[model samples]
Target: GKTQNIYALNYNDKDNDIKISLGLLDTKHNWSGWISPVNGKGTKSDTPNKRWNFNIQKSVDLTNKDEMVFGLQYTKDSMHKTEHNLVNGELNKQSKGNTRSYGLYIQNDHKFDNKWSILSGIRYDNWKVYDSWMQLDKDKSKTIYYPARSDSSFSPKIALQYKIDDESNLFTSWGKAFAAPTLQKMFSGSASSASYTEANPNLNPQTVKTVEIGYKKKFGESTILGVTYYHNDINDLLYTRKTGLGKITYTVNGSTYTKDKQRVENAGTATTNGIELDLNHKINDQWSMFANYMYQQSKIDKCSTNGAAEGKIMTYVPKHVFNLGVDYSAGKWNSELVGSYQSKMYAQDNNSDTAKGVYTAYDPYFVVDFNLTYSMDKNSSISFAVNNLFDKEYYSYNLCEGRNYMLTVDYNF
Candidate 1:
């Protein structure tokens, strides 16, 4: 269960070409679940988070064909979490992790003529962990601490667009992306089957280079179509490695040691090639439809530990996925139906589809949802939705949601 509060305010002065915004967010979550089916015992956890940020943006016209954009932002965030397990009818601390980050960015957009334009941008980030410690009831003397540390990253992107004509356009883009390891990934432990994972604060950010080409066409006011092809080269991809004991190194008491534990690491290099197609059409004011499909192939090129692992498909990358939806609106009623489909996907690295439970390949499935809405007036409406209309049984690493129903009443001011 969760509760959240978010509020923001924006001020704009068109005469000065300036805008300022302020926002705050607070959230709380509580979770309780059985640790195992054998026992009637359970575990519970509570987490609270808060954040505040301010941003200022300015737009300057360098000339008729060029413009510059400036942005400054600052944010503060904090969170604390506690976990407890039923032990003789008492509760005890389990573990906790904390994080903070700051960011700044700027962009430039230049128009060469009516036919071509270019946009470029850069961003900087500083993220750090302030506190992370843990002590389990089973191992009281094994208290662990991840020293406070900060990392900085800089990313840049550029894109270009060309107008083929009034009804069609073409575009290509390239970007460098960065992602720091999350707090939980940096300091957490879990288990599955015969393997277990321990945190590694020495993990580096996952980096990737992406290139894309796309085209879109508008046919009158009734239809729109688009197609895109993309490729991504990923380096230092943060991933888990399941190897023999003593394959990983750790530090303790000012001494270096090796252990046989599953850990997160910059495992290897990967590449992804994909194509996407989408279409939107209006049959009339009362009828509309949209469809999209994607074909993706992702593969690990080389493994840091075993070169034999190369050329294997990346886990969870479905080779095919598609969605189709139709909408109808007439009189005081509106209805929509959407169908989605995905091909089979493996759940583990090294293409080990023989593993049991979640470690095996997940079978393909198709799901459908329908929504109906009735308007009581211009100010209020009622809606009914049926998810998984066919009650398809499926799994994406685990059992997926079954058929469900929902009713909602919405009022507008």
Candidate 2:
């Protein structure tokens, strides 16, 4: 079943990116997202998820062989969802929230003679959730207002490299990473209409400490191979409880009310040990092949729920992933083919979806894609692509898309 509007043309917004590098200064600005038109009557959309980022970097000389880099960055992210009643043309506001982030970082690269080199960097980030509001309506009516919230963190990384002969090299590094809740999670208020779900504003960020070692080698100018083994220790990992309960308060029409709200919490700790391999080879002047594979094992080191989830594997994280691809080029024609595979995956923490005789899991699946392009000149090209070329049946929770084809024409000014 389908419908069509033959007389109208749909216009979609595009991303805006600008970058500059001059002398010792470098800067980048990017803005993109979908915003529901507040006044466009015929268009429909999900919650608007608008984002903006601006960063600037400067290079300074600490010695001639040693260099230091300084950077400053700012970011803004917001989500606003609204819907209009079809019959009466009345507008209703569902959710509104925004967040801002400021960051500063410094790094130094030092070359100690011809055989040894090192890079070290430290970053500080501050995030704030502000100017957020939520209401089913707008007349001093049913609404919940979230309080302003903030979080800050410091992360540091260091790496060293050594020259082995002239064709191969070895490297090792240690780094700290952190993830904080998004504006949607930190500022969403409880919906009075829902009986048992509410939002929390005081959740802690997840953090990981990583250590890695690796070796890489180049065989001539057309071939390269690299491999790495790494481990991560993650704490205060964030997972949604879904049925989490907390108290909420709001006022309407000279009356105040309070109720329990359900949301997510900081609930677990985990560790991952993994190995990755990458290889690329150019068979000749017109043909090349590339492949990569990852073997990862992650376990729940601790669970706050203290039940079936205590020792289970993390959800949706596969133990194996492999990708293989090749490319070809002729006078005016270019072609590529790629194949990818994933091992089995579980969809939930409980791992209990197996109400049947067997535990239901997402089956391992493989997919392949092909593309061909013809160049008309230096400024234009036409491409035809076959995605999911075999139309494999699979599921990552829900059924995946089937085989499809596309043709595109691109031009540059």
Candidate 3:
């Protein structure tokens, strides 16, 4: 079971073009299930998480062709989890942590002329983690405390656009960004008789540099087409590495156990290049259609821990993807039909799992979906939807969901 609550407040000054916002979120989850299929051991767990957010921004018109905007943002997060064994009714594990982040950014939009425009922005962010610890077992009286860590980064982005005409444009952009490791990736751990994971508090942030170019144009009055190409270079990619196998002693039972230890590390560098194409057409006043396709190649250039993964395709990235959809509307009724396809993908970094249509494997799949809605009046509507209309069987680490149906009614005041 899960419960979530959210609260938000906003203030807008229309005369000055300024906005201020504050938000809070609280969430809780509780569940009990079997932990081991062979032994039929059961366990219960509880997790509670909370977040606080604030933002303030102002927009200023510097000239007839220029605009400037600046903003400041802050966020605080806390998470905790506890698990107990059902058989013995004893504490199995517990983990808790808090994180805080601050951000400042400024952006400008400038038009050199009617045909040329540029947009540029810079952002600075700082992140810190504190008050983090983990307990393995209550009866064993063992605990681990993680040291506090902090890091800061700066990101810059710029884009230039040229309008070929009123109906088409060409644009190019470059940017640099970073992503900090989450609390679960830095502090969470689990252990079994065969394997165990260790938490690492010294992990660094992952960074990427990106470049993109695109063009869009309209054909006649009802058809539009867009195409884009992009490349990315990533550093400090994180991955799990099997450190070694060692003997560990359990104090509660006074027994020794052999287990393989795994830890997360900044393991490799990767690159990705992709191209995307999109098309849209409107047929008369009652029908419209859209289609899109993407081709991508992602590869690990170097890996520090696992040499076998070098030059291999990255995990969970499909080489080709496609989507097509059609929508219709008449009087008080509306309908939509969509279909999507994905090519084969690898599930492991080493790309060793070759058997498809099996557990822990990735397989190519195509699925279709449909939806219909009827407006009862100006204030009410009813909808029916079907997901996975063909009931295709595939694996994405696990088996994907089969065909399903949903009916919903909505009303507005």
Candidate 4:
């Protein structure tokens, strides 16, 4: 016999454009099972991660058919956690991380006619972090810890949209995005893997430039179509290297000196392009169907470190994805069926030595989900849904758990 546990979150938001939100997140996890060579006792782990956020958005009208909008957002986040193994009573760690960010954005919408309109917007963000982690080599013993460092960055986004007619619209836009490296990567001050000899405290943020074009069309009163094409170029990816740790001896209390050489660099660049399409049709008042397709490709344009990913495809990003679903509603009964598929994707960055081979492509797989509902009255209904009907075997984003089915029931009173 075995026991399992769960953790959850609940949030509440109030107000209009300028909003306030609060939430609580907690975990109470325990597992117990009986097996051959291991202790049948259970394991327990308790942790909590929480955050409170506030956002503000407002729009000003410049003309009868034109308006400009602006927004500001802020968040405060914190986490506390620990890990332990029940069989051997191995104590792990209890640490936390926190961050805050603020942003300003503006946009304008103009209408030229019933079938023609244009929209554009620009945004800026300033982000900051506290309690960042870093690894270091102190004394002869290696230790990992957080370093005191405050970093900030400015990023921008721009977009434009044009309407072709009442039934169709075409649009395109370009923007820039950025992400700062984790604190552990910088200050942990120690290296466990052979890829990095030492942590780089001066690591820069990763940057990306994205361009996209899209169109949306409506046919008759029961069908709609949407298509989009996007491309992205990224730069300044962090690269790690190995450095020799030479033999040395020294006295600790009075005179102890050790010597080591660390290797570090920031050499990473890449480009990705993709296309997306979606279609929805209402065959009648009792039946409807929806379909979606996505195709993407990513390649390494530059490499600064010795890794399988250099000059090869980015890890985990698949080249194709698709989904289809149908829904039926008649009188007091309703039902739905949905399916999704994804093409094979690589599991490693380098094209070499992998337990399953360098180009370990996962098999193409699909999942079917179903749902049913019954109306208790004109104002109330009850419903049940089962996700992953066939329980297909697949993984998204490499390290995540594979597929599973879920049964859900909802009631309205």
Candidate 5:
């Protein structure tokens, strides 16, 4: 179960072309479940999170063909978590952490001529993590505190567009970005009867560089086509790996049990290349259709810890994906039908997990869905939807949901 609250304020000055915004969020999530059905053991967890942000931006019109903008942003976030064992009435695990960030950015948009235009931006950000700790109780009680860490990065991006005609254009973009590790990945740990994980405090941030090129065109005022190719180079990717095996002692009884232990780490470097194609067409006033396809190849270039993972395809990334949909509308009725398909994907970094029709297996699947809505009046409507129309059976770590139905009603005053 979860609950959340959000509040926001915005101020706009038309004459100065300035905008200012502030936002706050509070959230609470709790979970309780039986750990073992045979032993009647249970566990409960609680997590609370809070965040606030402020942003200000200003735009300047230098000339009819050129414009510039500048912006500043700041954010603060905090999280706390606690887990307890019901049978023993004792704390099993606990974690708390906070993060802060500051950012500044500048952008310029310019048009050299009627057929050429360019957009460029640069941003600098500083991120800080502090006051992070984790505690775990298994065979014994232990507590670990993470050292404070801070880092700064600069990202830059540029895009150029060439107009072939009024109905078509070509565009290309390149950018570099950075992402810091989440609080859960760096300061959270959990223990159970069969498995456990340890927090990693020395992990580094990940970085990626991307380049993309695309073309879009309109045909006969009823159809549109788009194609794009993109490449990404990533460094310091994070993944969880089995570290070793350890013994866990049950507090209710002094019995000890062996379990697998895992930890998160900066695993390796990776690269991805992909191409996408999409088309949209309008057959008549009451019918429209859309289709899209993507082909991607993602591979791990190097692995510092496991040699088998190098040169293998990344886990959970399918090589091919496709989607098609048709929509119809006539007077007070509207309906849509969509189909999706994906190739098989691996479940392990080494590409060694091959059993199908079982738990923790990845399998190829294709499914179709449909929805229809009838407008009863100007302010009221009802909708019916059917998902997984064919009841396809597949596994994505666990068993996928089969065919399902939903009915929705909407009314407005």
Candidate 6:
């Protein structure tokens, strides 16, 4: 176990949001504006971020019952990450890097009567990376420096919706999304000391193109059900690859000065397709139920990862997930129960010799949660909730925190 006081965590965040809507005029003209500013800081262990953003829009009536909306938005952000570690009984990790970005966006939404609608938007983003103060090897005490780099691109999206009736609707969307490498990725040079793994500095931004179609139907008086099918093609999927695990090598300006650098490549490609279903049903005046199900698959198209061949499933992506829950209320009492399940998934490809057998695959698991509430009055209540009711072993986003329980009490007047 690590020592106490060996690490201290500090954090600070401040944010402000403002909005204005002018709705007094006629239907021919209306305007709205929104603005936000955010700032954050942390100790030597986390990243520091700050940003400012604003959006304004105006709607104009074009003829009998149809309207055209025009909108513009701007955002700017700056981020910094400090790298620190202890080495040779001394604090020698004083690396720092930063990134800055600016974006411009425009969007429009139009409605025809009340049966059909369309939405479209486009955005341009530009960003730069600054890297410095990186060490390659402590044994030889070598360091490497990279020049600042910058890139920019455009992303767009379009969606359409049609009302099938008063209780049903159909919609579809095709969109493109982009992400830029963070300052940590750009400055954490590909050098591993005696303790840490090599960090890739040449990492590139990942991108994905997605298409989805869905339909929603409302049945009975208080029940709703919907289903969606989605497919995505991704490029430049970034991942850390462990090269030959031999003695490390370190260099400076093309010369082999130290022997502590591990070779690595930070790029790959992936494709994912999935189907999702959601339902909400009211059993009576005092009881309701909800269910959600998802089936998805991820495949690595290109990579040299362990057991990752041309069309194998990616690591850590479960194929099936289901969640069911119920809520009840009667007079002054209310309660809820929810259960979730996940299907088994492979930790590595089947062909690999070291691969765990099918039976040893990650096991399917279930968890149940419960909540109860008592109304002290019309304007007050006390509630208690317990998560992981059975304390079943499970993982969320690759992390396990064990069973958790909490209690909350509130009063209003």
Top TM-score prediction, candidate number: 3
Write model 1 residue lDDT over 1-413, tens digit each, in one string: 88889888888899989999999888766444335445545555566676778899999998998888888877666555565665464545556667677778888999999999999999887777777777655465786776888777787889999999999999999988777786556655543333457766577778889999999999999999999999999988776665643554633222345555777778789999999999999999999999999999999897796565578887668999999999999999999999999988865566676443343238788999999999999989999999999998776666787899999998765
TM-scores, all candidates, are 0.80, 0.75, 0.85, 0.70, 0.82, 0.67
RMSD of 4: 7.8
In model 2, what is the error at residue 42, expressed in angstroms?
19
lDDT of 4: 0.61
Order of candidates by TM-score, top first? 3, 5, 1, 2, 4, 6
Give candidate 5's error at residue 126 in angstroms. Answer: 2.2
Residue 295, model 2: lDDT of 98
Q: List ranges where model 2 is wrong by over 4 Å.
A: 1-45, 58-64, 83-93, 136-142, 186-201, 220-222, 242-263, 305-307, 354-363, 374-382, 408-413
Model 6 lDDT, residue 284, Cα: 95
| Residue-by-residue lDDT tens digits, candidate 2, 81-159 | 6544433445654667778888889899999978899999998988888777766564537777777878888999999
lDDT of each: 0.78, 0.72, 0.84, 0.61, 0.84, 0.63
Residue-by-residue lDDT tens digits, candidate 4, 75-153: 6555443334456765433344555666677778888776556666666655555674421222323334455445454
Give every collision pair in model 2: 197-262, 198-262
Per-model tally of clashing residue pairs: 3, 2, 0, 16, 0, 4
On a 0 to 100 scale, what is the lDDT of residue 371 in model 6? 94
lDDT string for model 5 (1-413, tens) is 77888888888899999999999988866453445556877777777888899999999998999899999999998888887787997887788888988889998999999999999999998999999877765533477777888988899989999999999999999998878887777766655443466677777788889999999999988999999999999888876655333544443223345565677778888999999999999999999999999999999898786677789888778999999999999999999999999988986667877888777678888999999999999989999999999999998767899999999998765
Clash pairs detected, candidate 5: none
Error of 1 at 284 (Å): 1.6
lDDT by residue for model 3 (1-413), tens = 87889888888899999999999988866443445555556677676788899999999999999999999999998878788777788887888888898889999999999999999999998999999888867854577787888888899999999999989999999998878777667766545443466766667788889999999999999999999999999899876655433445431122336655667778879999999999999998999999999999999899897788789988778999999999999999999999999998875567776888877678899999999999999989999999999998998767999999999998765
